[model samples]
Target chain A: MNLHGTPLSIVIFALFVAAVLFLSFFFARKAKSAAGYYAAGGQIHWAVNGISFAGDYLSAASFLGICGMIATLGYDGFLYSIGYLAGWVVALFVVAEPMKRMGKFTFTDALDAKFDSRGIKLAAAISTLVVSICYLIPQMNGAGSLVEPLLGLPHWVGVILVGAIVIVIVSAAGMTSTTYVQFLKGGLLLIFSTILVGFVLSRGLSTEPVGLESGAPRGEMTVQATDSQLLEQGYALLHTTGSLQKYVRDGTTTWWKREADGTLWRAQWTSDGVVNGVAGGVLEPVGRLRQIGGMSEAEAAAGTGSVGPLDFLAHLTHPETRIEQWQKQAVTDEKGAKYAVYTPKMVSGTDQMKPGVKFKVHTTTEKLNFVSLMMALFFGTAALPHILIRYYTVPSPACARKSTIVAIASIGFFYVLTLFMGLGAAVNGTVNPADNNMSAPLLAMSFGGVLFAIISAIAFATVLGTVAGLIVAASGAVAHDLMDRFGRMDLSDRQKVRAGKIAAFAVGIVAIVLGIVFRGVNVSFLVGWAFAVAASANLPAILMLLFWPRTTAAGIVASIIVGIVSSLGIILTGPEMFAGPYGLTAEQAWHPLGQPGIISIPLSFLALIVVSLVTKNRRVAVEA
Target chain B: MLHGPARSSGPDPASGYKTRLGVVMFIIYCVVYAGFVMTNVVNEGRAMQTIVFAGLNLAVVYGFGLIIFALVLALIYNHLCTRKERELNVTRSEKGAGA
Candidate 1:
């Protein structure tokens, strides 16, 4: 990616960061009171708030992960868009006006409104922190991922950079700054992605794919040997009947075979090309076609091994092969250098769809489950804490509602465009085989240098907008919910704002560290966990408190705690976490692979009802 | 009659109409959802898969029937609360008149 020190991109990014900071500081001056800092004094126009909603809601996962998944995996990615949009129905029809009427500062305030219970406040606050942090991890991870390819920096550097920038943005103005940044990013991300999509369609598909070397298979390849010496030295021995040939040393192989000229020859295969018809049977050039039987018309036209232009939509909508070829080697040496290997069955398509091949989404009933999961991700956006907080910045509840509607329109349209952009990347032939996250950026490169630079920069901005909003939400939980509500710090407005700034910095640091730790996990899947947790921990409490008259303060507290703990427990014990990080086997894992919503959400609701029923008459007394 | 805050006395007539409208709309949503679910379950043959997929799509896109349910529940609650408010207001006015 070698994007290091691109003076123009650096200048552009720096200016953008500075502009956001300046806006924050400007808002800071107006944020003289806790209400102003926390809720933008509830005076912002609906249009601005709504666009900011789009900005805050479309996190790195939405832009990078979903787009990348769609590019690589097809229609499954669009399922995320559908799920995300549907979640807004819940937000608009259920949560909006009631939330505005109930809470003054944070989501916690709303839950504890009727009960006035410190226990409820503490529990809700804790849930907010946990969900916020869980959601923040993927955002931070996306930031780090973007930084490397965009600015040519190390992954950790990218993580730290986003963390620092977000803290400053949050500390400077609070919701006000966070709102505008989201507004800017949300608008820019859509516009730029639209532009990128246009470029993709205009470029169209070429009959002859570009950037591929002639005489190589459509997919990547590897070699295996059964001897330690061959394994250590990276050589393979080819045997036919009674004849034997060894390919070894200095990136060249020697093999004997009949040539196309009908002459026997020994040839050496070099990294650049094959020298055939003499020694090792004339290293014949491998054309960009692999013999796969019974391919569809769309598949054939796209390319022998890659997706084509006209069939872009077809490839996206239909199932295709996902091949992962690995060489197995046996080493007998003490240092484990030498090995013998053979090309075991190269797993491709339906074979790769088997469990344990790759992530479950690429290969199981989990694929449809994955679609439902992504739906949760997409719909979960409008209901998020950081997103809802932005509504308070708007002037009236009507504006909040209107802005949300606007957000829906804009976000909805952008998600539609993601389908095209993702398909374009899938067939573009410029994709980094290992990193699907780079699909959009790499697709941009296929067009020209300028488009690539611009898209990459906008992707960077996408991370910034999302991270800033998340940091604000986290800081609010700490300073407003914890410090004031729980700690009972009767601090002045200025002191509270200062405390929030400090909290932002601390949370930002934690985010950066976690981002570095979970480096290679799919951002989209991680996002699913966040949504599951949010739905379980926050959604149940908020929904019940607003609608259920019998919902006691104890119920809210119990629901929040139970929701947070159970969801976290399910996630920690689920296959992805247990097998991957905790070093446990899949079967030994406590729950099924990923569907926590199916269980934890119900449990949270049950806990709230049971607890409330038990303590229906016991109301908390408030001191005057 | 017991005295109370005027705003909390009872439901306005206008509010009652709104509540009825909300309930109607909610019923429409539920009916539509039920139809989709039934069609999905009953249909067979090759077209059955398509129908089932559509049903799944509906469930995913509308959010598992919860949004409609929430709206209906909220409307009912609002209707009850508004009635309570109006009644309280009327009771207070009657008490004052008697005094």
Candidate 2:
């Protein structure tokens, strides 16, 4: 999976980064006032804002994390995609137009729009920074992962590089630069992903170095097809001594080993040469598809040469098709040795297309995790500080609605493409199970080096765009919501812009440190935590402020505080954060599930309602 | 210290229609989405994963169906909301002329 700074990919990545910097400085000339810096003078076209929304939403987690999951874990990965896109529906229908009508700049502007209360502003602003920082961790983590393979640099270098670049991008022109960068990256990601999926369909299925249907019982006799006979009896020896000698017999290398069960197995024969980006002659054609299941009698005889997109799916669901599936388990030997091992099984495509492969749904607690994660995704989109602020960038309420629809279309298309990209990686041998974040880019490499380079570059920009958006939101919370409103700085527009710039740099530095601190975690998994916190803290206030007339400012403030505290508290004490942060075994972690939304989201709403009711009479007394 | 509900705030029909439409669309969306989540909860994904359409499993197709279905609803709501906003503007201009 390590490209090791392949010259072509590195060049492409550098050029793309350079282009992003140029765009930032180019737009810097237009960022004059606080309004222009924070919200692009509220003049962006709905279409541009819509595409930027797609760019911002489709973070490294979307492209890299989901693809890696799909590659390694089949349909379980698509669950994330479905949950993410479903969240957009809430954004478009419930939050978009109303947010535009209400807010001027930061997300707190929307919350404080009616009451103009300092308590509300402080609470919501703090929520913004908390959610933004949690979200920033994943983005920076993605950046670090990309750096090792793409730039041949240390993980910290990648984190610092992206953190510095994003700080400059936000400080230079604020949202204007971030929007254009997102627009460019989003459009490129979609178009390139489509092209990659097209290549997958054109170079259909194959079984190079094929085994006895892949999942034959290890150390047991099974029927393997050889040309000399219709079917020959053989066995698989996964582990052997002497570094395994390779023989070039009949253009296929065979490895021999003595199994404890006393059976002989031969490795599948190889077809020397390259066909449609698949290279042979080498033992591991990492980019070439080595196995597939479910074919007609004649099709099996012919070897599925190439098929259309529909045919690919048809072959996938044929009930006979077996996909290459991998399972990882942590094991301890009788001698007390512990290590994680991966076993690859040829799974039925039907099973691969189902829900319970990676994230199980059998146990009640597991189901709770699934539902909570989905809730976080659903309510989190509208409440995300960066996404809410985008509603302000457009001109009118209708424009906000229109832009959201456009973002939905673009995002939906990309999610569909992720299915193909991930599936293609699964069968094509491009999946790096150790690091799922590398799956999409490595899948691109399986096709061609140029495709790999381009995808990795865009993936880098994907990180930058999302990071800038998050930092801009954080900086806005700091400068406008906290300092200007609550601190009563009463600064001029020019001074406000300067304060925002300085805040952006500081937030960017903090993100770099956190990104370096939390390495090797899946970006998408980290993002789920952010969403849970955002849904818990920010969503109840926004939803009630717009719909419930009796929603007192005290309720909004209390909800924000409770939501942020309880959700974040659960995450920090959860299993995922236990091993490193708390120096405890995951079994010792207190939270039952990693996702806190199922509990925290309802609690926020309850807090808002109860506080509002009790405080309503107090408000009346004040009015008298 | 508080603004009243949309209905109580002088009966602006555009805002009123928007509020109603928002509620209905949200309810419909919740039902459809909750059906997907609850299917997994109830059957643990066994019931919906049956092969129903185009030889694809219901879980796969239904998951995708939810995504595209959301876009279609958004487009429809946008069209209706735009028309209502225009109607409200025209009514206001006519009143201005009469005054």
Q: Per-residue lDDT for A57-118 in model 2, tens only?
A: 99998999899888877788998898899899889878887777667788888788777789
Model 2 residue runs over 4 Å out of place are A209-293, A296-303, A332-338, A521-524, A578-586, A620-624, B1-13
- Fnat (0 to 1) per candidate: 0.00, 0.42
| Docking class for candidate 2 | acceptable
- Tens digits of per-residue lDDT, candidate 1, A486-572, equal 777867768887888888889888998999998877545566777877887778777676556777788888887887788678778
Q: Model 1's CAPRI class? A: incorrect
Judged by TM-score, which candidate is best?
A: 2
What is the Å distance of residue A214 in model 1 from its true position? Answer: 17
Q: Model 2: clashing residue pairs?
A: A293-A321, A293-A322, A294-A320, A294-A321
TM-scores vs. true structure, each candidate: 0.73, 0.87
